[model samples]
Target: MIDKILNTRTILAVDDDPTNIHAVAGYLQPHGAKLLVANSGEKALEVLAQNIPDLIILDINMPGQSGIEVCRKIKQDTRLEQVPVLFLTGSVKDVSEAFAVGGVDYIVKPVRSEELLARVSTHIRLSQLVKSLDKANLLLESVNESLEMKVQERTLELVTVNKNLRIEIDERRRLQDKISYLSNYDFVTRMFNRNSMEQELKVVMETQSDADARSFLYYIDLDQFKIINDTCGHVAGDELLRQIAELLRGGFEFASICARMGGDEFAVLSQSLNLDDAIKRAHLIKDNIENHRFEWNEEVFKHSISMAVVEIDEGIDSVSHLLSIAERTCFESKRKGGGEVSIYNYSKDYIDKTQQQMKIIPLIHQAIEDNQFILYFQHICANNDSKLQKIEVLLRLQDESGKIKPPGHFIPVAERFHLITEIDKWVLKNTFKAISSLPENIIVSINLSGEFIIKSNAVELIRDLLLQHKVQPSRICFEITETSAISNIGATHRFMLELNETGCLFSLDDFGTGTSSYEYLKQLPVDFVKIDGMFVRDIENDEISRKMVESISGIARAKQIKVIAECVESEAALNIINNMGVDYYQGFVAHKPEPLMNLFTLVK
Candidate 1:
């Protein structure tokens, strides 16, 4: 049966003979396929250029371009390669030649309608199947690509989650460790608590016998700690305690046990040491405590540690006795102005000392109220010459008894009562008043406490004072320690710029004494760098100190700032500083701090 073909099938027939072309067209007309005819092979190639056909019918044994030539050309052209070709020929050799040029079939010259229609329909169905298979392959490729992308995204998400989980776990472990440490140790000092100390002490006692020699217990109470805490705030007091703990821990490596007993008290137990050796160790610890300077918020404080050492013997049965002996000795040290070390001797008479000195504090306060606070000026001179370039104003207090007390006597007490700011204000106002009265070119510098700088009104207060006195700001310098300037950089920078804009200069006092001196020097806007007294005092004999001064002096010169060598006590020290290119020197060798009235005579 010949199935009726649709217009979708397009067939092109090429023949040089007009009869052959007409016969093929007439036979395929009932199949409903669109037929295009060309009389020559050249004409067929031209027709192929205009339209793409699904099927081609070629007649061999024609003129010029033969059926084999047209078929070969059609198969070679990639655009026409998909079109199926059938050859119609009278000769068997011609039909074989047609098949060799990619023709699917060849029929005799008298063409049959049923056979032609069947072959054309079969090729059309095969072509449609090939196109459907190509589409399915493309769809599969798109699906594979989408699946790969989703897998990659999920892998990245899992990796990110794993990294976050590991970090969280590490943080949790660190937090747990910190919590355990805090629970078992003192937060301020990182030292064992009283309970830990007691447990260690029992173990120590069990291991020791009479043949092991006697052990000693020393209880340390920070003298004037209450005063420091009250005046400097609890933060400063805590810092002071922490520093003391560190110093004590470092100083006594042979001590069997050590712990912070509570508040400002600490206990140290030493084994296998005689009374003399123990006493010597206590003295060494005392010196380290008294000499060590603690910085709190840029303010430097020297603390006095009072020690009470008790020797434990076979006769002493109780730990409380040792604690009491140490406590009493500490009390005695406190009673005697609290800067010295004392030992507890059980054989000596116990001194029940109380109500012995209640009259001194009031007398001191009254003296300050009565305008008896004395000002002394110490000259800081140029190192290159013996010229007096600057003077450091020192405070002295005269009591009603006509006895003068140094700053060490009442400053701590005053600071405890939050009276230092008032004292500082008075100093500033009077110091400016004093400088206003000085010679035109002479510049006087005053040391400012950290508390003064922290005050919001500090810059304004200084500016107003200078304006009121009509004092040239260049002639008045404010000195701050390196520790102070670096502690609060933002506040310090604003204060420095504001005061510097008004021509008031800043001197970084004790410049090389701090850990952050270099950092502070870079960030602080200052006019002068004061070499600390420790370096200056030893510059004559200490090679390291001399080199440090020279290096710092050179740096200061490079920065276009003046350098002042403080505490120049000897001629040797003076010569060394002068050679180092130091701009100023201050010490007993230059001028001792004298009364303000006396400074006038000296300046002239």
Candidate 2:
């Protein structure tokens, strides 16, 4: 009489008597089912908090908290209520109490094994069927709501038409034409959207002659438009986009095809332009955009665009492939600064970097899942002190072949895909565990991304880790890049201040590479400013580098903030920075990064 439905299901049996619990377990174990036993009603609730079983078998009597009370609590919780409860009552009076407390069915104690198996099987089968139907209903409702919204929009448009016979006839034809126009063009800028552009590209590819030279696809992205959009309203942003669309159409020749792919992005297709001519054309567009200013509410704002140009050759098989290459190259150009251009020529170096960027996403997922990421620490020395008083932690990924990949190779790609948040969490958890085992006074610094800094929950996660690992806040330091701080000043300030209050230190890394005004520098409550490595690398030989170092040091000194010099590769560079009144030195001259475990053996 047993069914296969109960074979794989789990059942939790709760009772005060060991003999009755063993009886239920002995009967259920032979059926190829799992039985979890709880000694009392209180113990049953603890097990239920962590696991939801297909069925709960409860004994009504002989416990401090009765089985009826446990059933009542389970029914009150919507997540646990869907689970069927089967009660075992020794008396007929308790059978009515079981039904009142939301038990699906009851069997009297001194129970027969055959009846126990039959009731458990029936309830488990029904619970699964109900869950399946609930999922189906949710999916159907989503589809219905989407369809209803579309119908309502169409109905509203139909109601606005005139009533005259002649006018109504013309209105229907006009509406059809309007629909066709919208299908191809963006409503706001009146340029071709992504879908329409692909259809046109396909037509051109089919009709073009084989003898003709390759055309060019220019992917243009507006820079700093987000800042303007966020500061001003969306209405102003729309006006700016419309103006840019008109500028693009007017700047290019009539033969060239122009389109707006989406928000703050536009593209142009040019035919028969040589590399030199294309470069000049790209520069012209850049210069025109830089000079133009938009006026809104008596305020003026300027914007620039970054562009990538790729050849539309026979090798490109689809629109997506061409756009992806152009977009990647465009991103590289934008990295240099605003109004920059990059050409995708399939050169070996460009191809290698692009390929690495493409592969990094999946590799990051694998690294995190397999726990293959590791930490290395580099020593930093304070002024005139040769000891390794502080160390900065660095992260590296290990491949399956046991080769370690540097952060430079993967960090940029990880940042682009928003995977940095997960990577940072992994680093914080592991690093805190490592730091806890080191000397109580040893300081370790970890880098955090801007995206993580902006999250409201990031501080809570860090605080919990610190408490769990038993690491002192003063022994840890957080390093953030200068540009990241300036990008979201309010959030960055709050993140730094909150942690600083807990005795954790903050450092402004890559200083002097961002804006030179130095006003925001005072607002950020950081303990140290690490001079950018580019300037520190040749401080002894280069006069400009020395002056830049001196100027940055003097400002930090004025604010009572310590300064750390990076890239101190040689004795001359180290001597120069030391004389410049820098408080700390970090580079090969001090000590290179090594695995935390290899550096020393600590009590774990």
Candidate 3:
């Protein structure tokens, strides 16, 4: 710092007399300024070449090159021109010439010590202030540039947020439309309702005017649906209906129309089928239904369906007539012990739910390959103390058209297809890439899939990733679902132990949702228990949920595990959780999940 301050105001003194230069140097060097002395103007230029002093002192009358000529040369060289020049001479007559040649001030020969020192001090201080002002200007420009960049980033974030909100609103509208549309069909089976089928049949019969215009109708009834429902309850029966609907949807041709006409009864319309094709479809549907097995509650149930086919010729003028004929034919098959596919003269056959779950499967693979996945972070902080802040990483997908999709759309499908492990790895890799830019005091927590933890070499992968990213393991926390961890306790326990050795912390997410949460909490090496939203969201209103949160918080506190309350959407919920000794609160009220690109602004 001394050198810096000293370097800021270096003064070069030039004269033919050593005594004169020595006197000048002696006066200025003691006043916290560096001094350079030259006995001639030629040597002064050499000194100037080596060090561009902030202030230059010149003698007007020199041997080789006069001070006027040297001052002319200094002014000609733009690099040296800015250094303030003070001239020393015997005559006051040279003062106008000195000023003309760019000399800023003059000190006469036989200089007084105080006058020379005072002038030198004045010029050097002014030069230093100018230099400081220039530096300040540059610094201000840099700060403005940084501010512009931050504003642009913030604008982009707001645009992204707005885009996501629009997508969400659009999704809700689409879901509502689907719900309203589904109302015309069976919700459990996702098949057309009896009214929809009858209306569709009416249209077909009325639209096709040819006397021989034909369609095939099939009536389907599950043979053992009642027995299964009675034995396994309605939940299992509903699941059975869904599975059968999928089979029927897949087994028939694309042109065929199928519906769940009523309980345990279904209908299919083949608008362009002859006796042979209709019979062939009936046999196929019959075989597929009998072979399919529905598993529920660890027990497997196999059931067969009876189907009857009726031909819709011009002879069938009414939708009711077609349905009645199909029903009677189906009853004949039911009388044959319910496994046969019966057919009326020139007859049809078949049977179909969550349409979105199927749609998301392809999107999951597309997203992973296209690098559409992105990271979002929600801040978790102490309720009373804002200093204690952390971020929980959340995953989102941006599709080809630039729509941001929340994880809820695709995560279930990914889990179903066992593609969640790959997605988890993608998240971990990207997260490590991002975390190094965060502030040292802010810790980041990433979620680990239970399946990935147990099935993959997750500990080794995470250790390698942390090392590769040059991130401290202590800065990261892994969140695990309580029920998932319990499902594969042995493997999950080992994974936690090995990773915990590397200083990674753990949080049991959705804490109170699982059975035996307290039992498993004792065994798992978790540092936090994130209270489930179900309990926290209504804690202020519902006594049972409030007690559940209290019990979980109490148990967690007893075990030395800090508790975090999630989905804290209101100040009341935050206050309630805070009063219960919960260590942290996270939800929309506190912070929304934002893209990690803005993490620098968030860092402490």
Candidate 4:
């Protein structure tokens, strides 16, 4: 039943018995299903609160809350009511109660593998079909209501068409003309469409006689167009785009062609003599749009645009290639804080940097395979008595030539290829093993990449390593950045919850940098909040930075999360943050990162 079309499914197994959970996982995982397990009904609810598993294999008779009670609670929740629940009960007596409590089906204990999978697949497919039909019914009802209202109007039109031949001919001609117009023009802006613009550009390139003759393709993309569409409605968004289209038409009269490429993107092919002329025209177009404002629902929006000019010369390849360069240039403009113009130069360092980064991807693979990644440790000092409470794990890549490389060079490249998960795992396994020889009081903190938390195997990998190293989970700390948690809150929540079971501490690393929402302290089971170094370093003078530190400390204190200020370079800054309620500090003012062998000196 798990076919190509259905893809992978997620199943949550709730049972106190380890054997039952194992059976459920064995049957499901092989068939491309993700398995989540909880030993109790309350723990199951905690999992369900964040994650919606496709099929739930619930146990009926448990110590505290039975499967029926769990099903009843799940059905009571509006978000989970639609989810199908399957009960695994020992007694036939529990079958009827299971159904009464909203169980889709039931499988008696001593489950046959084939039968369990069959029942699970059947309920999942049926649930999907039911949801699909419900959605289709709503759409079909709306369509039928509109068709019923149009029935009389259509009947009258048919009769009129039979009576009057001239009117019918005129209607047909009007429809044909409209179709012809639409084929070459945009429906929203009434400008040349992408297809027509390609033909026009081809014609221009073929007709050029002089060897020195050149044109510039100005590709423009509206900045923050989604914000306008979201704040205002799509209708208002379209109106603003149409207005921008009009402004472009009026502003760039000398331009050979003005076209609407697609959503929030426009283009103009200019036959200007030099790059300066093209740049000036691009600036004028940008200025014109900036000067104008569109109002909707009493809200005014000043839309800005990012545009790029690519020179079309004899060296240019084709229409597609030219367009690609133009698009890339425009993206660069947007990336540099939009509302600006960029000229594509093959000599620019961005292309070179990209090429260099591409080379590192393989290096990352080799490093992981060969164990070239090395570790360093920095002490997180308890400010009150200048005692080091823990050490933050730092990663470094040793190149083939035997020189140590900082994480800055290779970490970003690793993250770009989604290899940071493996790197984090490497860190955990090695960190746990290394710390095995250290004293238990020396808590070792490992920084987890955003990529690691979202992976399903993160918890399993950590658990196996912890067991292999025979390390106490309480002495191992996993540091997750605020940016990582906010990216996929549900996956992060589940990962943290599962990992928390091992008794490891969590620190919301780089605190003041992300969403800056203090609610994370409550949502995440974080034992510590490590304030971003940028804020901590400037807290001595900057009022806003000081306020941020104070607010974080005040709220985090209320939540009982200890605050650790990073990059505390000055005693003045440390004093300020210490007074502001920061429990721990990490910077040059206290302790610097050193080789793992020197970790013992941190606590000393």
Clashes of each: 5, 0, 0, 0
TM-score of candidate 1 on Cα atoms, chains taken together = 0.42
Q: Write the per-residue lDDT of candidate 2 for residues 1-604, one digit (tens) a residue.
A: 4547768678999987676788888888788788888988899999999888989999886335679889999999887998999998764335445755777777766666766776688678767866765564565456456545755766664434223333544554565566567557876799987667767777777766755445778888898776676677556877898988888888888988888775577888877547668777878887787788998899999887888888777877877677767777777777788578888873336745766776887788788878899899888888865543688999999988999999987889878655788789889999998788787757888999997898667888899999999998998889999999999999999999899888999999999988653787789998989999999998888999999999989999999988999889999999888888899999999798888886566333
Report the number of the highest-TM-score candidate: 2
Error of 3 at 193 (Å): 35
lDDT of 1 by residue, 105-177 (tens): 5666666665566556766665655555446556545655654575577876766655655665565556556
Give TM per candidate: 0.42, 0.55, 0.45, 0.50
TM-score attained by model 2: 0.55
Query: lDDT of each structure?
Result: 0.73, 0.80, 0.78, 0.79
Worst 10 residues of 1 by lDDT: 351-360
* Candidates in descending TM-score order: 2, 4, 3, 1
**Per-residue alpha-carbon lDDT of candidate 4 for residues 82-182, written as tens digits (9 for 90 to 100):** 88899987644345457557786677676667568656877788778667655655665565565556655677665544445444445545655765675
- Candidates arranged by lDDT, highest first: 2, 4, 3, 1
For candidate 3, write residues 233-300 as lDDT tens digits: 65677788888888888887787788886557788887543678778878888898898878888888
Mind sharing the TM-score for model 3? 0.45
- Candidate 1: which pairs clash? 231-416, 380-585, 381-584, 381-585, 382-583
Which prediction has more favorable TM-score, 1 or 4? 4
Task: Provide the global lDDT of candidate 4 against the true structure.
Answer: 0.79
Task: Please give the RMSD of candidate 4 to the true structure.
Answer: 17.4
Clashing pairs in 3: none
